[model samples]
Target chain A: MPRIDGPIAFRGGGFAPSDRTWAAVATLVGVVALWQAGASAGVIPTLFLPAPVSIARALWALTVSGELWKNLSVSLMRLAVGWIVGTVFGIGLGLAVGLWSVLRSPGMALVSALFPIPKIALVPLFIIWFGIGEGSKLVTLAFGVFFPTVIATAGGVDNVPRGLIRMGQSFGLSHTAIIRKIVLPAALPAILSGFRVTSSIAIVLLVAAEMIGAERGIGAFVLSAGNLYDTDNLLAGIVVLSVLGLLVSWVIGRLERALLGWR
Target chain B: MTDGLRLTVDGVGHRYGGLQVLHGISLTAEPGEVMVLVGPSGCGKSTLLGIMGGMLAPSEGAVRCAGDVPPDCLNALTYVFQDFSLLPWRTVAGNVALVLEDRLSRTACAARVAEVLALTGLTDFATAWPRQLSGGMRQRVGIARALAVRPACLLLDEPLSALDAQTRDLLLEEFASLITAAGTTTVYVTHNLAEAVRLGHQIVVLSRRPGQVRDVVRVDRPLAERRAADPDLMALEQRLWRMIRDDAAVAERERIDASD
Candidate 1:
């Protein structure tokens, strides 16, 4: 095996060679400067569009008063509860549908139909069914996250090399053992990718649920601030939501890297 | 303990999606013998090996193991995959340890894994992940995993075809040494004449598609005594080539014709 290869491996980092990290930063700074200038010049009403500086001030005020921390913790607690509920059932269902042919078809049909209907669309129905309480919010959150897990698990199992399964057979392992040993390990990367997608799903569902009926969540705060035309607080809430989504995704990514070490 | 476990394949026939791949093929592997399956591409040598390994079901015929292989076939067989199907998530030792996890006591299991790791020249690789190792090392891990099961019969599915010639030869010697020490009944599949000549006790040559038993040649000398230029080995290689070259040519032509 003489070396004849060029670029056998891609170098991983903050950005690839063709990336636009600097351009993105420049655009962010330009948008902030322009928005602040427009508001100060009275081109846009402060009540309609608070300047980036005022949003920053609101963020600092909330940060110092510890209101952000308290509300952020409450939102995160809801997220954790909802995610755990969804993840456990989703992973169990995924592994089940992935392994058994009898259960896969109708199971996936139900999931495909239910996964894409806006979780918010079900909010009113869930409110009628479970009342305007935690049950409705949780039901919405779980539904949003479960679909990706099922898709991931099935796709992972579907394309597993038949050779690997036969390899297990030669070891005198039973059919069940082959799935537990060979199939699961081989299917993990895809399953993990599915989990990654659902983290975003969890956040989107959480925000939507909060906006519909919640009193203490970031989404509720944004809605209330819009009702009062409090632009600084509304912009601040969006910033907090963005930050929360990023943090949640970052945590899932870290866990994925740690567990799926070979990848 | 000294009794031979003879595998008798009687009138085994099988087909895949209307295309018959094996036709009443029969062969035997005696206990502690290294039986090599050889023939050109699409000759069903692999399919035969699969049937023997119980990875595939033959439409007709049974794999009869007479001695040493537990009367219960599932308890006595192990396989080494060509792709070295080691679990990427598990370390080399972990892959080998999986076979013994339920059966052996932990202390003894650890020792057995350590011993096989050393036997396969994979001691330093016990903690290494599969992706971190080279092709040869991964195959060694596969061999170690099979051996760790303390199986009476070992199945090899073209285990060295993915490796470089040098690595293949080196590993071939290593496999011979390990099997000789263990005295396991082994069935190795490969199309390479040099591998068959170097390591096989009995070389079973198969015919192209709808495979049948074309010839069975016995190598009388010990693998250690059979040198590279041995006249018997060379003559056997020539005979084996004559049996397979035309078939290989036909298979190759079919591929080109299919593509065109």
Candidate 2:
């Protein structure tokens, strides 16, 4: 028999990774500090890339003058209307496509054909059709959000276990009851994850649509600031957009925790 | 106890696409009796169970249920699945309440859910999620959900096949008592010989693919009185093993040959 070495070297410790919130916070803080230090020493040009402190000052000025709320409110309204409209219609059509054979092929065909086309590229076309107003901007965001929401909802519905549905049927559950009780809850985790994606898409399209034609949104403000060589406000507007994304992500996380606590 | 329903599967056969899975199988689950279907893998016992429960339409014949359904019975035929099939999003009581929700008033639904949870010894875990439970506990939830409807008949498809041996043994004793207490006719499909001798009043053995009934063995002893270590049951288990041993071996070899 071969003698083994003391405590045979442990090799199985690592493939499992866990979240460290502190590490994420520390990394973000470290990068901002490094950028601020470089900007103060003139190692990085402030004209092109405004310092974090300068962006903060610009934001404060905008807040005091009430201009930030003016632009932000308009953008928030557009996001709310566009995303809600798109989501309602998307989930409806997605459920139809998932449940029925007649709609599955045609709906998926349309999604596959249109999902890859960039919504930014169609902004000019929407402006032409909807007359360069809120109509055009809302349409752009809604259109961008529609296809992915459809795909996500349909996929979620498709992935529900057939056994669960069969069990529901065996219990003599009504057709609508099976879909509402068994199908919906089973598909929820996927639909919630899809919300995460579509929310980010809505923000991106909001900015693009505003940059093209709107006069009051943050995207328009950022573009105007860039045109006037006001790097401070430009960076400030971008910061607001990033912060908005973070806020939306945090809301979705809370929604998942509440709805999927069983999982 | 509710009067058990008589489930008759008359000349039932089923084919999936181009393949015939079950051929000319006929059996009857009598009122208030356990009918155990035992066979080798690929014998389509699950398919037969599905057909018996009206979950699947057999290609050749029909299934009929004839008996007085209890006034409070929400569903006449209920299934306890091999995988438990409890919704992960619903609590233990909520899963039991699912079939009752549409049929009963809100208070009545809650009452029935509470009754089944207590019956299954799961009253303490009523608010727990399915994922939090062990395999045995999850299947208890499955059985509880089935019982919540006051089902006249139960179609259990290898309910203990997914559990470990110790859990299977423990649940086997519980299942015998549960079935006897409910007095509901049951059609249980499994490959385990011991389970057949232990729970089955009538054990129906089947041949391999395109399965047909090979033999029917009757045990006159009451389910609760039967023990796993009884000499009679052990002898019966050995007899059943001998009956299906050649078929199981041939089916296994066919699997290997097809894969090769």
Candidate 3:
């Protein structure tokens, strides 16, 4: 230290960055505006990629004709039923694998072996087994959703602090009580994050299954539009799918805020 | 008040696989007395505590509990952990209420939770989460949870060791009064000599690993009357430190060597 005449310069402030909601919204709006301008000036071929305004007009026409809800409702039902059934079974088995020594190794082994096989690849096999009906479509989505949920739940359970479990035992808590109260809440964050992954998987598998077979649904509508070379309707269908994803992620964000506010 | 339980450690010895940690440790914690276990870092005091609390099984010997249990005691023996194991997901009141839910009715449980929160001066922070608390406040929640059970015997595993010196000093005074008032037999494990001299009715000094009893110093003074700055207590603290100084140095060296 030579002299203490000057104030020290601060050097520890750049690594931490805060999120800006307005910046994200502005970027999306800017991209759409640029795309619309290019389409109007005929600088880009609308035949290949429809302008955002054309996609919006197609969506409006579909909504007015009731075709949007008609196909969307069917897809939503498949997504809900398949995702719920998969989640219930996955969570049950995951808890078993987490809590019991008898199941941990065998359960994890099966999950590791089966989780890597893409569910989209099983669509043709499912169609042959369950027929080209709702049965096959549902099975495809559920199968895709199941493995990830199990892995997430098990991983969550594994990460719960041992000291907390020991504290529960010391208090003479019953095995069921400990599992329900202590283990479940501790693992909820991981399970919730797993839900985020599984939900996306469910959606992707739903679209793929519908494209392979099925007479109605958003995926069927999109595929038929693409076959007819109707780029506007195809992009409209894609927009609907994107909105569905955003709505789902928004719901999960709310759920996290409500449940994990303590964090 | 109902008589606190007597906990007896009969020829207690523990080994972790090939490593011998504690050996031939026989001692009795008389009803309603504070029995402090003091030793070097690797002296297996916490292992011994776990064995006594029935959380871990010792390699040899047994622990026996005798004497009356209060009717309201939900758990006969409860532990206050070194890390203040409050559930991060639950509020302070909710964490305290965990042990009571299965045993008590809804209203009764709520009442007991309120009572303990008040006892620990945490009534204002009952709805706060553990992550929202300071280290000292978190341990207060731990103590509140332990007291909520109305335990016949309390097993505190270095409960104050995680706090800052000022907080530890402040909480130590509170601990003495609370223990004296409850008259619950306590087995407190720590390496702090000042804590042992201040709180222990019988302070058990242990040697290095393969820990055996080196000495048991008896303090006849009442806990409420004991002070940290008292000349007698200071002398007692110095004496206890002298007993463990060589063993502690050796244990520290062994730890560094093992790490290398």
lDDT tens per residue, model 2, A1-263:
98777877878798899999999999999999999999999999999998899999999999999999999999999999999988988888888888899999999999999999999999999999998999999999889888888898999999999989988888889999999999888888888888999999999999999999989999999999999999999999999999999999999999999999876
lDDT of 1 by residue, A90-179 (tens): 878888887788999888999988777877798899889989888888877887777787888888988788877766666666777788
TM-score of 3: 0.98
C-alpha TM-scores of all predictions = 0.91, 0.97, 0.98
Two-way DockQ contest, 1 vs 2, winner:
2
Give interface RMSD, every candidate, in order.
1.7, 0.8, 0.6
All candidates: DockQ? 0.62, 0.90, 0.91
Error of 2 at A255 (Å): 1.0
Ranking by TM-score: 3, 2, 1
Candidate 1's C-alpha runs over 4 A off are A1-34, A37-44, A64-66, A174-177, B1-4, B69-75, B258-260
Tens-place lDDT per residue, model 2, B104-144, is 99998898888888999999999998889999999999999
- Return the number of clashes found in candidate 1: 0
In the range B173-195, model 3's lDDT, one tens digit per residue, is 99998999889999999989899
Question: Any runs in candidate 2 off by more than 4 Å, and if so which?
Answer: A1-5, B1-3
**Candidates ranked by lDDT, best first?**
3, 2, 1
Output the lDDT of residue B95, model 3.
93
Give the least accurate 10-residue stretch of model 3 chain A, judged by summed lDDT: A1-10
Where does the lowest 10-residue lDDT sum fall in candidate 3 chain B?
B1-10
